[model samples]
Target: MNISPTDFASLLCSRLCHDLLSPVGALNNGLELLADENDPAMRARCLELLADSAKASANKLKFFRLAFGAAGGFGDMVDTREARTAIGGLFGDGHRVELGWMVEEETLPKGAVKVLLNLALIAGDALVRGGRLDIGAETIDGHVEIVVRGEGPRIVLDDELRGALGGTAGDTITPRAAAAHLARALVTENGGSLQISPPDAPALMFGAVFNAA
Candidate 1:
């Protein structure tokens, strides 16, 4: 990519800022609650709020440290097992985001992992009523594909998300949308295509395809 040191640093910092935005918001909320509270009972509640927020932030940090952070270590080939686990962990104990492995040992760039994880997180948000999610990838005859599917009651397939996935212009994406947008950009940067849609089959799908040129 011939990226300069300054550009890469800026990218890394921007990525961190995007991910930590939520935890930092929660931190602010906790501080507000602490300030408004009185008495030992209320103080204990505030402490619990602070603790929970801290734990959530910590979990995200640990997961992102591997998925996006340098700690997972950078490489052209990313471990499928590690990427799957990292995404699942970041989504946490609520929704059921399943990985249906078809092609084992499929490897992609580190940025690919980060993008997929972020997209899955957005899809998870869309399936608020709890549903089935499918995550898998394949590489055949110099071609690669990754698919993320969600099936549930409500599928939040909005315009902004579609624009980001389709590489079109749209409103400024929120933190949640940033994941999917970045995923699309990552895939495109690698000469791949991203397609996202809500199926009449009651599914929300995010798929990417890369062909050796």
Candidate 2:
């Protein structure tokens, strides 16, 4: 409710520490297992686990580095093709949601790639049941249009998720809600708008638009 600046900072640090503990712990456990094991095969498996965990950690850092770290490095306009490839590489699972792209002669404001990546992550999370993702971008009236569509079993569109995309968090927001809320806030802070459109049939579509200067 009412937190002083010091208390708020403390809370933020606690949250970050809590979030990182699991992966760091996994790394520690994997190292211990490697040391305890005598078989080469077992050590190899532990190394694999360590490698996977490290990649996950690095991927997340890269995602956040661009989304929340700095701006104006890529320039006033972003390359759609490169953005699509980078985002897909981080989130694509091949079998589950097939990541498809349609970026023909289109670019957006400097922060557009971050918004697109956020949309892809949100979309990928929604399609846990395996689906197809169609990503596209276009420039219309000095605004960049981006769309992410999913086709799967059913669409789950909750109010909190919608609010998460709106860049606001409610009292009962979950961890996922907070992450998405942060993403939306980052996009909105960069002068963009997010929209989630659930299909009447069996599909989910979410996207965003940012004005280009």
CA lDDT, candidate 2, residue 33: 95
Please report the candidate that would top TM-score against the real structure: 2
- Candidate 1 per-residue lDDT, tens place, 115-191, comes to 66766777776787777777777676776677788788777776666666777745444444455566776788778
How do all models score by TM-score?
0.69, 0.73
Deviation of model 2 at 143, angstroms: 1.1
Report backbone clashes per prediction: 0, 0
Clashing pairs in 2: none
Q: Local error of candidate 2 at 207, Å?
A: 3.6
Can you write out model 2's per-residue Cα lDDT over 47-112, one digit (the tens) per residue? 999987776556555554554445447466665665665555556544466788877865666566
The TM-score between candidate 2 and the true structure equals 0.73
Model 2 / residue 57 / CA error / Å:
1.9
RMSD of each: 4.8, 4.4
